[model samples]
Target: MSDWRASREAVELARLGVSELLANVAKHTASRRCGLRLVRVGADVVVQVFDESKQLPVVRTPDWCSEDGRGLWLLREMADGFGYMPIPLVTDTSYRLGKVVWFSCWGALPEAGAA
Candidate 1:
């Protein structure tokens, strides 16, 4: 495992992102259950949350009086890059989506996607 002490901020951001992602899952997914998959690519980490919602996540501008709708907003601020992909599963009542969130710090100097 890599030492996250040097990049605690990124880890913390990932934590926050994951929290909001999961919360969104609970609130939006057509199904009651959701699954999360995390993978490490070089010095970066990618987090993907799969749910039954046929709709994709939207990064919306939060209303001033709203207490929610700021999850992906915070995630974009914390991630190096974010991606959304539709899963190719054959189903009628359920669908799967792939959300990719990457951390800027997590690997060694030469492995962190630096030039």
Candidate 2:
């Protein structure tokens, strides 16, 4: 994980972003199951969450006293880039519409021979 970036803070922030994405899925989606994928794309570590819902997540400003609706906002601030893409559904009856929410953190690649 540290290979993607020398800063431990960046890795931690990416983890938090993924957690928030999953939490949003559990709180808002009709489907209880979700998928998570992490990979190094170019100079960024991309965290993606796949959920069986076509609805795109909205980033909204919450009141200072509010207890909810700040997850995406925090993700946007922490990640270098964040967005969602709709997955095309198959014609098969077993398939359902879904989307993938992703966040990427940019940084230098891990040093050679480092784990």
> TM-score: which candidate is best?
2
Give lDDT: candidate 2, residue 83. Answer: 94
Please give, for residues 5-51, the per-residue lDDT of candidate 1 as tens digits.
Answer: 33566566667767877888778766756667767666666667766
- The residue-level lDDT of candidate 2 at 72 comes to 95
Work out the TM-score per prediction: 0.70, 0.83
RMSD of candidates 1 onward, in order = 4.7, 2.6
Worst 10 residues of 2 by lDDT: 106-115
Global lDDT of each candidate: 0.62, 0.80
Q: Across residues 35-114, which tens digit of lDDT does each residue of candidate 2 receive?
A: 88987756557788988899999887767698888889888877888999899656556776799999887873564456
Predict model 1's lDDT versus the native: 0.62
Give the TM-score (vs. native) of candidate 1.
0.70
On a 0 to 100 scale, what is the lDDT of residue 32 in model 2?
70
Angstrom error of the Cα, residue 65, model 2: value is 1.2
Error of 2 at 101 (Å): 0.4
* Model 1 worst lDDT run, 10 consecutive residues: 100-109
lDDT of 1 at 35: 69
